[model samples]
Target: MEILSNLALGFSIALSPYTLMLAVLGCFIGTIVGALPGLGPSNGVAILIPITFTMGLDATAALVLLTAVYYGAMYGGRISSILLNIPGDEPALMTTLDGYPMAKNGRPGQALVISGFASFWGALFATVMLALVAPALSRVAYQFGPAEYFALYLLAFSTLGGIASNNQAKAAFASCVGLGISVIGLDNFSGLPRMTGGNLHLMDGVDFLVAIVGLFAVSEVFFFIEKHGKGGAVGVKLNKFRVPWGEIWSTRWTQLRCGVVGFIAGVLPGAGASLGSFLTYMMEKNIAGPEGKFGTGVPKGVAAPEAGNNSAAGGALVPMLTLGVPGSGTTAVLLAVLMTLNITPGPTLFTDRPEVVWGLIASLLIANFVLLAMNVPLVRIFVKVLSVPPALLLPGVTMVSFVGIYSLTGGYFDLLLMILFGIMGYVFRKMDIPTVPVILGILLGSNMEDALRRAMVLSDGEWTYLFSSPIAIGLWIFAVAGFIAPVYFRNKIRKPQAVTD
Candidate 1:
């Protein structure tokens, strides 16, 4: 009954003409951004945040618009993945494995339609799950203390090595790099600069948006240049869009299973949509056995990851809204935006800012419907993004990224910092190092440090206090198990295949 009443209130606000229009506008803009390689949801939201302030919109409306863009970008990412063999964003990487092949096999239209439907179902299901789960979770989160929170952060960090990268050492190193970057601004406890090097800009530490745009967007430019303009053509000619009813029916179970998997993974801090999509694809391939045809135009292959990633996007919001811990890069930006608006997110947010919380939830549902309606009919148009020449596309993307960062900081120094990070990002990518852990580390490092210090202060510097609570102990145990479980399972699975061979 409480949920029902809140939904009523939420719908009333979300359905307002002004809020509805913002949602539509956000969705449209997000699709364009997502269709363009490298300009992901994070860049799209971060760029628009300053514009939102200038528009003088209320907090609820601003959040609604930004979050709609987040959802729309998730929906649109599959377009390039399917048609051009290029992932529009990191999470869409898994889709390219099967989606591109499907297109190459003369079924680009079917692939697009199927992926769109899969995305719709994933987003819709996850929105319902969010509505059901978040309120209760927020209440439970209210019970967490510094020790428990620190342990939870440990769990998030520990799991990343196993899920995000095959090379655990590289992931660990990337995380350390992020943590190191986070410590640059100041020693919050001592009120003294730690790594400022006498620069005022460094006193504030590295901006997350600057790091994101540089790593994902600018690094992409470097990568394109390295490719020397090769691989730019989309050989597959898309036919008129048609509903792939047969394909959808066939992959129904895969979509549902992956949707649930994606949502659960997204709820875990630092797991994000990339991990969710990868895990779902692997699971579907393994389960289908010989019949899966995973690499060569399997509808289920395309559907699973698309569904998983989109659902994970919804799942990522749960921790951000309920606990003030963002599960992904995009959610981290949303958290920053909320803080900028003077709306603190956490358990108290639910009670104190019911309108913002519920209205955003309602807007998510509306955005999913809008994406579904728009994506199917307009897929051909979206796919046309593939025809854009690399010379024009790369420079345009670079311009947008620079403009967005400049608008946000209004500083030439920040641009130089972004260029520096872009070089670092390109180097990291060329070396096969994963970037997500670094981003996650930067996002969570400060909060983790604060929790640890607070816990120590309470215990008079006794480290054992960090594990005194049952929740803390349990989380610590889970962290250890998460680190170990993947290796154990991999070896366990490989032995059987070895025996068969």
Candidate 2:
């Protein structure tokens, strides 16, 4: 009954004229961003976050807009895969296997319509699950103290290396680099600067927004320019876009099963949409056996992965809203946003800022319907967005990154640091080091350190206290297993026509 009232409160905020308009605008922009190759939900949110800060939006409005963008990008990722045989982002890779084949059969519009329907059902299912699960999880987190929190942070990093990166060694290196960056400011315990090099801007450490823009948005700009504006090729133009209501009806079971698989995957702390899509595709393929014709562009093949990835995207929000641990790279960016707004995520968040949490939830529900309505009939407009040259699009994105970060901070040193981080990001990309863990480290490092310090103070400097609680012990075990489990599965997980990030 209380949850019902809370949801009603949420709907009231989400239905407001200002919030509804932002949701529509965010969905439109997010679809365009997702149609562009390489800028997935993570980059979409990061690029726009600084702008929200600059605009000085209230926390609820900012969250509503950005979350709309996140959900919209998940829907938009399929546009390129169905029509162009090019995945707009990593999770959309599986869509190409069956989607492109369907497109080649002169049914480009059918492939798209099917995928859109799958995306809607899958996301809707996960959103329902998230609503049911996050409050319970937050209640459990109320028992956590310093030892448990430090261990939770450790689990977050270890899981990222194990599940997010193909190479754990490189991910560890990136984690260390990010932690190093986090410690550059004044140390509260010592009351002295640690690694500031006597520079004034270093006093507050690296701003999360600046680092995010540099690593994601600016570096992407450099990559686009270097590749000579060849982000996507529309190999199969749509001759006609017809709604496939029968196809949608046929794959209802496939969507339900994939939604379940993807939502569970998303709720897990490091297994993201990539794994969800792959697992669901394989699950459907196995269920169909020899006659399913999954690889040759069957409708179920198009449905399975689309449902899985989009549902997983929604599922990834559960942990971020509950325990402050991001379940995916994009959720990590959203975590940065919440922190920047001075809204610490944990058990109290629901009680302390129910409006923000409930409003964002309501907005996601609204955005899902908005995306379905817009995508079903108007997908042709998003497909045309692919024709816009990366050369023209990237510079404007870069300018936003520069201008947004500067306006928010007003620090010349931050601009220079951003450029340096951009260069560093390019180098990291060249080296095949995943940048997500680095961002996670910066977001969680200080809090982890504080937890450790508090634990030590309570335990009188005893190391054993770090593992004193059952939650702490479980987190340690989970962290270790999370890192090792990926190694065993890394060889078996296939990436058919996988696009490099």
Candidate 3:
């Protein structure tokens, strides 16, 4: 009854002409950005954060547009991966392994069509899951103590290694660096500044947007410049967009299994589309037998990863919306945007911000259909986007990053920080040290500190309370496992592969 009422209200808000138009525009721009290599949803949305602020649009409208761009970009990202054998971002990497082979075999159009549809289905399934699960999850989060919340954040950061690179040490190092950077601002607990450098400007610490932009966008630009200098991109000619329903049906069980797997993975804190896709790919490969050729352009091969990634992207929203803890980088940006809007997300969000929450849910239903219509008929146009000269696009993206960071703080210092982090990001990218964990540390460190202090206060200086609650004990167990599981499993796999080779 409550959800129905919220949906009705959300429909009223989302159906407004202004919001609808903004949604359409955001979706179109996001698709274009996603279709272009090196410009995934994170960069696409970050570049536009300034634009959203400058326009002074309604927070709901701004969010609706931006998130639409996010999902739209995800849908479009499969295009280049399939046609050009190039993933637009790290998450799309799984898409290329089989998608490109299909394209190379003169089925570029078919591959794009299937991948796009798979993305749409995965997103739709996840959206429905969110609508059903978020309210319940929000209710559960209300029971959390600071200790539990802190443990949860620690668990989230630990999961980053699983989501990103298999290197636990590198991931931990990245997370530590982020925590150090996050502590640069005034200490909220001590009431005295720690790393302000005696500068009044540093009193507020670094803006999250500035850090995010520098880390993801500017860093990406520098890296791309080194690889694609003053040249055009490689192109592909898309032929026909056909579904081949029989082939799709043949993989129906695989698609459904992967879709469920993807959704479950998405619901986990810190797990995102990358983990979802990788897991789905591995699972399907193992499940395939003599009847299936595995990765050499089988339809199930494409469908599994596609479904998993799209579903995971949607599932990641569960924690972000219900508990205000992000499962991935892109969702972290969404949390930042929600904060900027002064709309708090947590157990009360569903009741307090029903329009924002349910409107987003309803809009997602519409957006999935919109993506299908757009990706199917416009497959050729998206393919041509690859032909866009890198010389032209790179400068525009870099300029956007510069302007966006500048607008956030209106300070040259922030600009300098952007450049510094941009270089740092470039170096991290080169070294293969996962950047996401750094973001995790920066975002979670303060919260962790807050929880620790609160838990200490409640225990009257006794530290044993940290392990008292069943929930806390459970979380600690999981956090320890998250740290150990990757190293153990990664080495286990590597040894066998090394022996086989």
Question: Which one wins on lDDT?
Answer: 2
Give per-residue CA lDDT, model 2, range 7-113, as digits (tens). Answer: 89999999999999999999998888777786888888998998898888999999888988888888999988888787887888889889999999988889988
Worst 10 residues of 1 by lDDT: 492-501
State each model's C-alpha RMSD to the native. 4.1, 1.6, 3.3
lDDT of each: 0.82, 0.86, 0.79
Model 3 stretches with alpha carbons more than 4 Å out: 230-234, 492-501
Ranking by lDDT: 2, 1, 3
Native RMSD of candidate 3 (Å): 3.3
Q: Candidate 3 has what TM-score?
A: 0.94
Please give, for residues 141-228, the per-residue lDDT of candidate 1 as tens digits. 8889999999987787777655555556776788889888888897889989878889898998888767766776787788888897
Deviation (Å) of 149 in candidate 1: 1.4
Q: 1-501, model 3: which lDDT tens digit per residue? A: 987887788778878888888777887887888888878877788778876887787778888898898888878778877877777655677788888888777887777777777787888899889999999999988888988888888888887665456567777888888888888778888878878889887787767777778878888788767876543335456765566777777777887888899999888887787777778878888889756787688788888888888898899889999988887778877777887788877888888878889998887777778788888777666667788777788889989888877766677998888888888878886777777767667766777788889999999979888888898899889988877787767754431010000
For all candidates, the clash counts are: 0, 0, 0
Which 10-residue span in candidate 2 carries the lowest summed lDDT? 492-501
